[model samples]
Target: MGKTTGTRRGAWAAIRRLAASDRAAGLIMLGFALIGLVAANLPLTYHLFETIAETHIGIPYTNIDLPIGHWAQDGLLTIFFLTVGLELKQELTTGSLSNPKAAAVPMLCAVGGMLAPPILFMLVIALFSRFGPGEMGSLILTTTGSSIPFGEMAHGWAVPTATDIAFSLAVLALFARGLPGSIRAFLMTLATVDDLLAIILIAVFFSSVNAWYWFIGIAVCAGVWAYLVQLKRVPWAVVAVVGVLAWVMMFEAGIHPTLAGVLVGLSTPAREIHGETTPRAERYASKLQPFSALLALPIFALFATGVHFEELTPALMLSPLVIALIVALVVGKPLGIITTAWLSTHLGGLKMAKGLRVRDMIPTACACGIGFTVSFLIASLAYTNAELSAEARFGVLVGSLISALVSGILLSWQSKRFADATTDATR
Candidate 1:
């Protein structure tokens, strides 16, 4: 038994090492996503994406045939959310979010981050609508597009507000200078809050009419999962069964099935985590890491990247969607986060982290704009209609790129500056 325990520890350690390995695949994934866009525009690749989207699956008993595109967006993606929920649970329990003081700066920053982009988006629309002849005017875009660059057509406003946790956190860890651990803790907390808000937006503003029965099923399964956790059952079979049930319930719920992943994640007990005297009930939920990292997450990325770009026009490139997304993610996210963090510290009496100065704030704020996964997920969830979804996707692509580029540049620059300053001060 002791030998078996050691082996398990060894295995867990290996997994941890893999998770820590700098072969971080998100950059590769982003590269693929860029490839997907280029492919979308290419003749052969465009056709391929369209063909992939057409694939379908369904159970023997039902008329409910779900398409491959829908399945990726709906099914495997839920596991991503589940992982998010688990991380969130950990954060709330014993991670950075354990104290109200620690929580204040991130929470306020998150709110500011969420609020700014939408306002910019809406203002753009309002300007165009007020003057641009309401779809009748020939307001040509200077950015090489046929249509005007702002409107309800640009309703992809909310796409760039998300902060993709894995990618953002990974980059945060890359600083050669001794970046404050508190910054990571702070970013994670804000991103989590941003995630929860995105979920609310997806459910309330984005989804269609609910089937009450599915809601009941989701509620029941959630209750069962909670009960099982409380009962401290750890067998793989038990978890597999409950996890399956949770998936089904989420599928039935009007809420996207991917939300089940988050629910499961949040439900996990944090007591036994990494040898912290965690409750066994909390342990079962987090044990799904291998599936999440190695299988589900990567698969979801594969499917999500399958967008077609065949009918590429300058008009499309300069559309309200493209500009709004770029502005929101690139400009608004950092601006909002940095401004709010300062205000929260000064006005709300929240203290800033010890070592980080006002200059460090800009790059950190830029990093907060890394809104890849959650941004994509929300784009999928927020728009049910094909036209709307396309618009959202366009925004998501543009915004994600802008955020990643600008934020990355800022972080790298700040990291160097921080190091030089430290050296100069010592000298």
Candidate 2:
């Protein structure tokens, strides 16, 4: 009996140790991201960055190969969306977003948040772009130009919208042991609202020139989704087939193919099964999650962010494209999130976790600025023009990295201070 208890305790301790290790590795990856940012901007690293940027990998059976980056976003990241969809389903079933009443404030804030950013960005462009070459002093937008010719301000619409959850949670993990649970919940709540808004913007605003055939394909994809919901003995393979078809259909439909993920995911059922083992739809999402998180996301991040900076030029760094991304994510996300949440909490009577205060919000809001994966994806969808995509992708790297770092710093400092205060008051 003594031996068994000792072994059991040892095993439990081992599990806890591993969990800690994973949390550490996550931060280290952020470190790698910082180094990557430095490498991307280095004058001597240009060749390496270009080589990595241009490298391709794809489905082996066909002649179809995309750069490592594209494979990550479109191919691998689809799995990420699958997981997101699954999470959304679970939320709809029993989680925070389960009911309309509970969801009202976050949903409304998310929509307003999305709309406000683009409108704000467009106004920024309308005002700044009129000034002509070298205008706005240093505040020029890097994402500019959508036939709108706002310099980099053209891409500004994309900047304020992204919130990187993995990075935010990483910030919380640094001292999550001592922090109030409500704060983490609040961050997740806000970011999830932010995500729904981001998805809508991508689907509606960023759509390509209409293709009727693609629209039909989308209909077929919708049918497949319906089948997934209706079929009594839905198989994982069927879900996979439908998911692939959804991607192809979205791509053909002149819609952003990644939105296919949201479609497929939303279509998946979260129904509890009776007199059986795993349910078909939930099983598929569960199996897909590991692949998406461990393999797909990391590979995507490495390739997408792995640029060498040998080509770094002061001119490029100061370009409107780069600066616009910085402004959108860095300046825009925090302001948009905080202002919206404040209004929602005060005016809309939205409830947050207890012990949460607006002042405690700044760090979490800053953390939301760490928009890595989706931000990079949106930068691609923002403009189909190749050179524009590359420039925007580079800008994503810069803005996201800077945002993650600063957010981490702010969150860490705030977490410590809050913990100390809580301990003092308790005493």
> Which numbered prediction scores highest in TM-score against the true structure?
1
Point to the candidate with the largest lDDT. 1
Off by over 4 Å in 2: 1-68, 103-105, 112-131, 134-148, 151-156, 209-213, 225-234, 275-286, 306-310, 313-316, 384-388
lDDT (10s digit) by residue, model 2, range 1-427 = 9999999989866644543343554554455555555665666775686677679776556445678666667777777777677667666776677776755555554554455555555665565555544534434333233233454437546755767666667767764556787777667666676777677777777777466876777777767876766566766587677778778767656677777777777776676655546544566666665465556666667655655433456666665556666666666767776777688888878865567766677776666767777777777667655555656667766776677678777777877887899889999
Residue runs of model 1 more than 4 Å from their true location after superposition: 1-16, 21-23, 131-155, 175-177, 273-287, 313-315, 384-388, 425-427
TM-score of 1: 0.85
- In candidate 1, what are the lDDT values of residues 1-427, reduced to their tens digit? 9999999999987875564442364555565556656665677667787677677888566445788777766777676677677777877777777786868888888889998987776666555555553355424242333344344355466777777766666666664246667676677788888888887777666666466787777667677776666553356577668777777655555566677777766665666644557654344345655556555656566556556543656666665555666677778888889889888777777877787654567776776666767777766665554544565566666666666666667777777876787789999
Count of clashes in candidate 1: 16
CA error at residue 249 for candidate 2, angstroms: 2.2
Give model 2's TM-score versus the native structure: 0.78
- The TM-scores, one per candidate, come to 0.85, 0.78
